[model samples]
Target: MVKVKKIIFLALGFPNAEENTIIWTDLVHEFHLQGHDILVVAPASNKTDTGLRLEAGVKVLRVATYKLFDVGPVLKGLANIMLPYQYKNALKINNIKLDFDLILIPTPPITLGKTANWLKRKTKAKLYLILRDIFPQNAVDLKMISQGGLIHRYFRKKELKLYRISDKIGCMSQANIDYIKTHNPKIEAAKLHLLPNWENLPKFEDLGNIDDIKAKYGLTNKFVVIFGGNIGRPQKMENIIELAKNCTEIKDLVFLIIGKGTEFKKLKDNVTSLKLFNVVLEKKIPKKDYYNLLRAADVGLISLSEEFTIPNFPSKVLSYFGSKKPVLASIDLQTDFGQMLEETNSGFWAEAGNIPLLKEKLMLLYKDGDLRSKLGANGYKYMAENLLPEHAYNIICKNV
Candidate 1:
């Protein structure tokens, strides 16, 4: 018989949000199915109040906190710094007590070290750090924050403390693992592991009415290329807009951008000013509707800022694969996402900021139906075989 363990998960987002399909939700569900007791401490959205609830064998504690991602840099940083104290206060007020066997945390804030350390000291829980975004360094790479600046130094100190507190650190890709090791030479090699983001195999219900979706979006008879989810600074969406601008002559091609972020307004303004008839920008749709839109499109587009030295992998590619849509990604050369596509025969890739190459890729996919079908199928197959919640669960179980 497997020994059941109690797990504590820390994250910024959780289920029942406007968009619910994400890495943490899937993994927590999988752990529940495996008969492990789980507790999730997540931030409450603007619409939600601080509370406790039970859902699908997982106990959720929603801590009332400032909106972390949608605010200004100063506000965001302040929230990140204060989240641990808020979480601790919530736990105390609720009189919640448990001896957790494992504590799992993902980083964007890198300020959860104090909470994790407290839990470890109190309950002897083994802390596992899911190192998704490499915090201050990524900010520095994007020139969002300067290296050795006050903000950078403060977060860097927090980053190191988090790493030191973790018993194990799981990276999203091999490239992520290497980047961490290279930058933080003090961190022991034994603590690092590759723990890629995962999702369940596509369910029949997820594939909504493709024809109706295409018509609703006015994508009928057009070779639709979609860039979905979080159109922000890190995405370097200007490259995609440039690609759309260059392809205005091709009446059959339509660039459908569905999502919102800090850069959404800027992108929309540029699209309107340029009079790019071939491009359409829409707010993020419901999760089900987004999947339907993916089914309606001929290609899925992924992009990262060319300025990044970090090999960031976007989880959006998995959604594209789930829809069996071929992907066309423009990523930093340092990122191994392009290599993943080539090795899997799942999609095509071009260097980020290379509008000419991006345009060439678009035209190639537009002209070839057979090539699109083959690549899409390959991606679906690869995802089904490799990127599953069960795989991620097993990795965590072994480490714990």
Candidate 2:
């Protein structure tokens, strides 16, 4: 008989409702059915207020954190920096003791590696580091940190140490792998695995009519350009606001901005102060409502600042594809996101921060009904065949 492996996944956060829960939940369930026991540890970020809701035979352990202003990079960094000690204490408080066969941790603050490292030392478990963000390099790329400064040097050392300690590494984008190889040639090619972002299509069902939803928000019969998720620096949504302002004369066009971030209030304030007619700003919605809103949207607006190139793939693209809504992608004209949108014929891409180009593309997609249908349908087919949860699980299982 094959021996069943015990698995533990550690991440600072997991989508308790809509984010990546659809994808991760399925994978955990499948692993359980395959006879492996799974445990997940994540920080509770407003999603699990009523304690833990059980699902898929896997046990989740979540701890509450302060959802203050610095939640994304700053607060997240502090939380992750303290993760090793916090996780150690959390495990102890729960009275959990285990010698796991495998441990997986996603890198962001790159501090989870310390927790993984600790678990390895304590239990002799195999550590698999999941590279969601390339860390110091991405931070530098976004001008968030100076490349040669002390902070950069510190993060660089931490990133390298994590990579060295990991028994296996899983990357979300091929560019991420290539970037790593370029920087550290000693990294064995076989140690790196490419597992791109994926979508869980079955979890979403059409909510039938969006007329009532639009009416509630005063968006009925408008060309709603829905842009959801974090409105941070990397998105640089100012130009999108400019476009919305320019298009105020057109009553049919409306921009719906949802989700929370450091930059969210700034964007909202700008629209409010300027009295921009076609803009409607909203905070993050519940998972089901968010999915329904995406389904109801006439165009999905995806924005990323021009600054980032490597390690900048947006998970929102997969969600847009799964929703079968044509996307309006704004990113570095040279990156994978732009190329993917162009190659798939699913959306129109404009140079990031180029308001005129954005306006033109938006008008084009808005006017061409047949083109929109064809593009949306094409995207759904591509997602079904390529970016489904099964594809991600297969890649992970192969690595295991």
Candidate 3:
């Protein structure tokens, strides 16, 4: 029999938020199904006070904190600094005490190191740090923060503390693992493990007909290229605008962008100013509707800022695979997602900000229905064999 363990999860995004159906969602659900007790401590959406709620048998404690994304840098920084303290105070006020077997925390703010350290000390829990975003370095890469500056130094300190406290560190890919090891030479190699993002397999009955949904979205007869999920700074939306501009004369080719973030309005304004008839920008839709759009589209578009040295993997690719839509990823040179695309025969990839290359790839998919179908089928097969929640669950279980 498997041993039942109590796990504490610290995350900024949870169910009902923009990240409703992504990595954290699937992981929490899987843990619950495996008969593990989960306690999730997340930031409250509206207020700065803690509240307790239960969802799908997991206990979630929403701590009062400021919004991280879609906010000014100063406010976001302040919120990140306060989250650790707020989490501690909230737990105390609720009188919640448990001997947790494991404490899992994913990095973005990197402020939770102190909180995770405290919990581990109190409960003797093993700390598992999921290094999704490599903090200050990624910020520095985008010129959002300067290396060796006061802010960078402050966050770097927190990042090191977090790594030091973690008994095991799970990286999204081999590139991420190499990045941490190269940057933080003091980190022990034994602690690092590969833990890719995963999702539950989609049932065939729920996928519905692509043609029916295409008609509903008025995408019928058009070679729709859909970009869904967060439209943030890291996505480099300008590159997408360039693609739209180049493809405007191709009346049969349509670009559908569905998502919201700090860059949404900027991207919308650019598209309008350019008078790109082939491009359409819409706010994030309901999950079911989003999936329908995914199926309706002929190609899924994934973009990352070319400035990034870190290999950032977008979980949006999983959605494309789930919907059996071929992906056309524009990625940074450091990322190996392009290689993954090649290995799986899942579609095509071009260097981000290369508008000409993007346009060429888009046209290739538009002209060949057989190529699109073959690539989409390959992606679905790859996702089923590899990127399932069960794979990630087994990895976490082995470490714990």
Candidate 4:
């Protein structure tokens, strides 16, 4: 017999639909399947009303707030700063309150300390911080905000407050745990827990008619190297553009970059200006279609800006793993993402900005179908053993 607990999740971005296979939704779905009572509190589109609604048997409280996610940095930053107050107010108006055992908060907005504090005081819930994005520093790394500048200093204080209230801070990688400990020594070391991203591993059988799916999306008859997810600054989409340019001479090999972000136009403009016909860029497709396109690919592509000092473990890589796709990554030296790839022998990686070496490695995979299959299978196995939703659920339940 298992105990059913009440859990509430606070997030800036959510999949919003069960059909969408996002990291947050995947883990929450695990709790759902286990018979836990789960509620997700998230930002609503400007067009959406603030209220409670049912989404795939889950209760979702959509808080009315400023601009939807993936907007320009100026609006996005301002909106995050304003969300805590808005979230706190929304709960007051709803009047459908109940006792909650745990408050799970994932950071990107990183300004939820106030809301967490309010919820803790009101519901007596234990707080767990999933530190997905190390703010101010990540912003500083991308030169989006200057170090010690007013914006940086303000969010830095907010980050510390968010940490102070968390009973345990779950990090995506050991590098992330080490970085947090070294940078924020004031926080107790034991508070940081390694909670890597997890996903619902779907079987290949569910992919459904690979050739039909690929032809549907114009991905057939090519060795597709797909990069599917957010195209934000931290991703350093320029490296991808340059790689596409360098790979122009290679026939039948196309770089498929799917997803939308602030930098999408810049990437599209570069592709147009450079006349790189081999690189296909699309705004993100429907969830299952994206998965099918990923599975149809010869390999998955991952990139991080060379400027990043924080170790970014992109959860999207799990999407690649779930699809049994090998990876070709251009990563920052500090990230340890490449290290994970090497440890599993799942893909090829070179330091970010090393176009020549990345090209060489890409060619190695391009020429060897057997190597791709072996590595892709290895990645799928690695994901099943270590990064499944059930595994993550067990870890979080133990903490709860």
Better of 2 and 4 by lDDT: 4
Best by TM-score: 1
In model 1, where is the ten-residue run with the lowest total lDDT?
A: 13-22
Worst 10 residues of 3 by lDDT: 13-22
Score residue 213 of candidate 1 by CA lDDT.
85
Query: Clashing residue pairs, candidate 2?
Result: none
Query: Candidate 3: which pairs clash?
Result: none
Candidate 2: deviation at residue 236, Å? Answer: 1.2
Q: Model 2 scores what on Cα lDDT?
A: 0.76
lDDT of 1: 0.86
What's model 4's lDDT at 324? 82
Please write out the lDDT profile of model 1 over residues 141-256, one tens digit for every residue: 87889999998999999899899889899888999999889989999888999888799875657466788888888888888999888988999899898888788888888989
Cα lDDT, model 3, residue 71:
90
Candidate 3 per-residue lDDT over residues 301-334, each given as its tens digit? 9999999998898888998998888999889998
TM-score of each: 0.96, 0.89, 0.95, 0.95
lDDT of 4 by residue, 116-224 (tens): 8888888778888988889989989988889999999899998999998888888889999999989999999988887888987875666688899878867678889
Global CA lDDT computed for model 3: 0.86
Worst 10 residues of 2 by lDDT: 47-56
